[model samples]
Target chain A: MNVMYFAWVRERIGVPQETVETEAATVNDLIAELKTREDRYAAAFADISALRVALDQELSDFDAPLAGVREVAFFPPMTGG
Target chain B: MQVRVQSEPFDAGAELNGFAQGRTDIGAVVSFTGVVRDTDGTLQEMLIEHYPGMTTSAITKIVEEAVSRWTLADALVIHRHGPLKPGEPIMMVATAAAHRAAAFAAADFLMDYLKSRAPFWKKEITDQGADWVAAKDEDEDALNRW
Candidate 1:
């Protein structure tokens, strides 16, 4: 699976993207797994409410099942236009 | 419909002139262009970041909705990313319809969705420092009008 970050989340995580092999079933579970890897991931995932998630490039919920998901993205609320 | 996500600056006037050109079926065309604001005059540059694949797809969905609801003949959306200076055009939305109301309403609707739905983030680089532009609550609320 490919995991991605953007904006301040990317800055906090210190990387834009990575390939992860996980047994997680949901977006939240993936975050929990990444949080245990380093302090940076922990800091980035500290405030889940301040973040938004996208599964396979579409906006999705953190509790969304990741059964066939290939990509996951996390970022702050968009400030486009 | 046409959607472009690029870092290159575009001439909004030229784009508007070319949109829905030579189309006898279209009677009205409306456009809105967003420009970078240097409110305090301390800004150095505005850096825009976007999710490459999602940005285009999200905006395309918004345009599709606008077209379906408004009876539009054509629509165009162009958004810029990367570093930009104050007063530079950030994005533009144009819609063509058989009537003025449809054209106007669709353009407005596109702006509203693009403000909060598209996966783009902006960072303001000022003389003092850099800060991410937070999404306003009103932007999210704007979608409720639809």
Candidate 2:
């Protein structure tokens, strides 16, 4: 699966994009897997409270299932304007 | 018809006029322009940075979502990404609809979503140093109030 980050989320995560192979079934499960990666990933996932998740470009909740999803994006609440 | 994430400043009047070109069905056009403000009660420059492709795609999604929820005839969003002086145009959103209500609502919704949901990050250059503008709780609350 491909994961993307934006804004300050990308700054903290160090990389803009990454490909991960996981057995996670839900967005929450994916976060759990990411948190186990390293300190940076843990710090990024440490505060999911301020984060928003989008599955395949559509906004979704953290608990949303990721089954069959090809992409997952995590970022801070948007600040575009 | 156009969505841009660029470093150069844009003219809202020209852009809006261009968007409304040759369209008689658009009875009402609503637009919102965001400008750079001098934060910290001091006159300082603002630097806006964004991921090029990601920023454009994210803003396009927000505009599309607004169109999905409103009866808009046309829409345009142009956001500038780079260093900007105070009072310079930072972003612009224009929406056209047969009725003023739909145009106004859709334009406002697009701005609200863009402010809270876009990939652009701002850094305030102050006398002290450059500091990335942290996401504010009030900004998020503004979205939740919708």
Candidate 3:
């Protein structure tokens, strides 16, 4: 799966996107998996409440299933206009 | 309906003039332009970042819904990404209908959705430092009115 980060999440994680081979069943599981890899990941995922997730380019919830999902994006709330 | 997500600047006047031009059936046209605002005057530029694959699709879906819900003759949304200086046009939405109510309501709805639902983020670069603009509760609350 391809994992992407945007805004402050991208800055905190120090990279925009990456391909991760994981057996996680949901977005939350994937975040848990990423947090163990590095301190940056832990810091970025520190507060799930402040984050938003997108599954395959659609706005989704953190508990969304990852089955058949190709991309998962994490970012702060959108501030567009 | 048309949704354009681009990096380059656009001519809002020309686009507005061209939209629904010479359409006798459409009597009302409502357009709204969002500009990069420097409220406290400590800003340098606003850097807009977006999800390339999702930006157009998300906005198109919103526009489609607006059209379906109203008697719209045409609708257009143009949003820019990348660095934009203060006073520059950031985005615009135009809606045309046979009556003023539909056009006005749809344009207002589009702006509300664009502010919160679009997959775009704004970062303000100020004289002191750069920071990501936080999404305001009022902006999210605005969606409930629709």
Candidate 4:
């Protein structure tokens, strides 16, 4: 699966884009997998409380299933105006 | 008919006039311009940063959704990224409709969605230090209530 990051989320994680191999079934499961990679990934996701996720460009909840999703993007909550 | 995400500031009146030109059916033109403000009530500067490709697509989606929900004749949205100073324009949304109500509502809806759903991030450089403005839950809740 392909994962993308944006803004400071990219900076913190040290990469803008990455292809991940996972057996995760949900967005939360994917997060768990990324958190296991390194300290940067762990810290970037340490406060998932402040993060938001989008599956295939549609805003989704953390618990949303990613069973058939092809892309997952993680970023901070939107501040655009 | 145009949606732009750039680093240059925009002129609301000029853009509105340009969009309204040669249009006989556009009776109402409504626009909203968002400006940077000093956090302390004093004149402080602000800086905005955003993802390149994602910002444009995100805002374009918001405009498309608004147009589908309303009977708008035209809509223009321009959002500036990179660094910005105090009182400088950060974003603008202009909507044209047959009546003022639809134009006004569409413009407001665009702004609401932009604040809560767009992909831009802002960093404020204060006397203390540089701080990235976190997305507020209140902003999200406001969108939810709509």
Best by DockQ: 1
Instruction: Give lDDT: candidate 2, residue A34.
Output: 89
Task: List model 3 lDDT by residue over A1-81, tens digit each.
Answer: 999999999999999999999999999999999999999999999999999999999999988899999999999999878
Of all true interface contacts, what fraction is found in model 3? Answer: 0.83
Off by over 4 Å in 1: none
| Regions of candidate 4 where Cα sits further than 4 Å from its true position | A65-70, B41-45
* Candidate 2, residue B126: lDDT: 78
Window of ten residues with lowest summed lDDT in model 1 chain B: B18-27
| lDDT of candidate 1 at residue B134, scale 0 to 100 | 96
DockQ of 1: 0.96
Error of 4 at B5 (Å): 1.0
Q: Taking the tens digit of each residue's C-alpha lDDT, what string does model 3 give over B1-146?
A: 78999999999999999999889998899999999999999999999999897899999999999999996999999999999999999999999999999999999999999999999999999999999999999999999998
List ranges where model 3 is wrong by over 4 Å.
Answer: none
Quality of candidate 4's docking, in CAPRI categories? Answer: medium
DockQ winner between candidates 2 and 4: 4
Candidate 3 lDDT: 0.95
Shift in Å, residue B66, candidate 3: 0.5
Cα deviation at B104, candidate 1, in Å, is: 1.2
- The pairs that clash in candidate 2 are A78-B116, A78-B117, A81-B115
lDDT by residue for model 4 over B11-130, one digit each (tens)?
887887798678899789888999898869644556676656467788888898888788788899999988888889998989999999999889988988999888787888877777
TM-score (chain B only), all candidates: 0.99, 0.91, 0.98, 0.92
